[model samples]
Target: MLAALAVVALATVSGGAAGGWVASRDGAPGGTPASAAPVPAELVTAAGKTVPGVVSVLVGGAGGASASGSGFAVDDQQHIITNDHILAKGRNGSVTVELPDGRRFAAEVVGREPRSDLAVLKVPPSAGLAALPLAKPGATRVGEPVLAVGSPLGLPGTVTAGIVSALDRQVRLGDNRHSAVQTDASINPGNSGGPLVNARGEVVGVNTAIATIDGNGSIGIGFAIPIDQVQQTADTIIGKGG
Candidate 1:
């Protein structure tokens, strides 16, 4: 059955988990059974590498309206990439970015491309956010493992695991039609604009929208803007000094 598409950005007042498992012996007291499936080491490593680069974007708009979503550092220049719709929800209001460690900074809107559903924000150089690596152009393949790293439901530093379910999936984002990388990762509200990274900790796409049945929550189907488009648009916005 066809499902409705949601932007995955949470609208509310500004407010905002780690994934790790310890291996236990066959009968270790109060420990997970040794027969339990182990978490993939690659995914664990990727999560660690990605969390620090991801940030929570809080927008305070006119009349106390606010919206929150996720973003990731893209360059050493303190530029962060996020979904433009999140900014739209705030009615062009002030933006703030909160680091994974709880440090918050006032952010300036560098630029936004609504058609592409992407936006860029810049914080002070003192923020010292780490830039996430991007996968090579045309590098993503179907069936590869991936992680959706973002703040789902206002919970910061959240990571969900899944695989590339399809490539070049046509979907509507905002008012534009674009191709997106489809995955089964659990992309919920507040995950907008966050990075979808591969097992090697390289960004493959920007989590943007999810298809939900009956306006419900994520049903294992999420879409991300391919990283190549993100890089091109982000570069143009940065170059134009927007």
Candidate 2:
């Protein structure tokens, strides 16, 4: 079964070719590709200025079955990016974004891409939205420091720091395979969909999951969807193909 799974994964990555897999450095499981280096610190602080536009998402049903996660505005027109699982319950839900100034606004779903675990949302510009610039995902490097900003466990504006543990990590989501950026950034349950910014504050990834030992908390291993795929998925969602 494992060999069959590997064959299927190779086929998917190679687009039906015989040898398709995520490119890695030195044949390591979590090595950086020969692309770009880490972002500088000054740039990260400047980028941090935009976190006020990141918001918490609340999905609910008619009788109030709900789940919550974090997200950030990506475009000036109130377009936001988040995890598709955060909105998996369908569109009959509402999102609330808390600005840095302690203001909040309601939002709606624009599009979602479950294959990539990303979702785009639309809220009024009056919500005081500030969008973060997307960094090149191919540039991520192992050992680089990163910061994750989100409402972890429902605590708004929580910030955590860690290093990029690896790059080009492959993980399974439903029937689809995803290549992600791995970090030791201490992401919690509510941290899903938040931005994982480099030292320069540019968004290199979106916090997705953390490895748990005893079903408790992070064991220094976490993963985020790469920003490159996030941009492509967001574009498709904006085009109404979520």
Candidate 3:
């Protein structure tokens, strides 16, 4: 099932599904696993460069309704890019951004486009956030390794690795249709609006949605808004007094 995603009010994450999978380094059946293999050097370098620019977006709505998602710094002006669905759920309530270093600040909505399912926000210049680098338009290739960085289920600064499963995939986002960058990364609630970066630490897309089995958790299928579209939309918004 394809469902719009978000973590509401920082809801509690269930561990029932997590208990089902088991790994063993010694090849023993049902035995606990030893230390996992070392992460590749490229991925380590990518994560190091990416994490600091990502932030946790928390929205507080009326009657205690709220939603959480992830966003990344898009420019030196502290402009941010995130999913519009996150703001829609908040119903025009206050928006707060939390940096990776535990600093929090109020954010102002620059603009939002429902058709693109994208929005722009700006923080004070004092935030001093470093903007993430972006890949060239149409530079992404299938089978290339990628990283999905976000705050899944409210856990901030989380990173998952996978490959670009496909590109130019037709998908419905909100009331509009878009050609998305498909990936096998583990995208869950709170991962919305985060960056799907390439091996060189350059953003290729914005992680937005995932396909689930029988309305369950992610089953390795995820989708992202291509960076070209994101950049265009963000530029348009920022240009108009953002």
Candidate 4:
């Protein structure tokens, strides 16, 4: 009954039988210090603008299987991006995108590149959605301040702040290798497919992987796919998958 109730919670967020999953795409970091700038009003404002564009990704598959995670808007046409592995957890079923405003929509996989560990999803454009801005290629710099927003442990609207620790990091997810942006953010299982935004609310990377010690959880080490890769794959998916 408890497990069923959890499924109900996810499905309710999806406004249907489909649900979401929360897993992170991050790994261990170099344990470097974060940016020391005092919290500015702009960072606060950025958070306000960002949270609305992110959504909980719920998926339901065969035999009552379900999972939940996080994702963010990339464009005005209702295209959302998430990790391919996050969506794979419920491959037997369908995907659901649940917004912060209590609106829900069914999601379909438009394109998936397991090699890049990225996937794009499509939902109906029912309202004027402000797509989060993606930074230009090579926009990330070490010691830059960043914020990670996602649902951790099924907690929605959760936010954690950190700094860019490194760049051009090669991390492996299964047989796939990706050059990633490293951060000292507190990313966890549920943070996958979300955005890692700069202090100005511009997205620099997609929160994708986290390194855990003993499989416990995040220890201030996380990785994100650079927005450049996100754009390349997403454009291809939109052109072909659509």
The CA root-mean-square deviation of candidate 4, after full C-alpha superposition on the true structure, stands at 9.3
Clashes of 4: 24
lDDT of 1 by residue, 1-242 (tens): 65655544333334421122322324435746568467799999999999999999999889877888899999999999999988988777899999999999999999999999899999999999999999998999999999999987677898999999999999875558989999998887789989999999999999988876666667788899999999999999999974
Q: Which runs of model 2 end up more than 4 angstroms from their true locations?
A: 1-47, 89-92
| Model 3 lDDT on a 0 to 1 scale | 0.84
Clashing pairs in 3: none
Model 1 accuracy (lDDT, Cα): 0.87
Model 2, position 220: C-alpha lDDT score: 74
Best by lDDT: 1
Error of 1 at 192 (Å): 0.2
The residue-by-residue lDDT of candidate 2 on 1-242, one tens digit each, is 22222211100010111122432323656656688567666646744674676777766644554567788889888888888776664244566656656776677777767788888888786886778888875888899888888866666677788888988888776677778888887777677889998877788998887765444455677889898999988888898733
Query: Which scores greater on TM-score, model 2 or model 4?
Result: 4
Model 4, stretches more than 4 Å misplaced? 1-38
Give candidate 3's error at residue 152 in angstroms. 0.2
lDDT (CA) for every model shown? 0.87, 0.71, 0.84, 0.77
Candidate with the larger lDDT of 1 and 3:
1
The lowest-lDDT stretch of 10 consecutive residues in candidate 4 is 2-11
Q: Tens digit of lDDT per residue, candidate 3, span 1-242?
A: 65554221111122112223433334647557689777789999999999999998888888787777889999999999998888887776788999999999999999998888888989999998899999999899999999999988777888999999999988875557888998998887788889999999999999888876555567788889999999999999999956
Ranking by lDDT: 1, 3, 4, 2
| Pairs with backbone N, CA or C atoms under 3 Å apart (clashes), candidate 1 | 110-242
Estimate the TM-score of every prediction: 0.87, 0.77, 0.87, 0.83
Model 3 lowest lDDT segment of ten: 7-16
Best by TM-score: 1
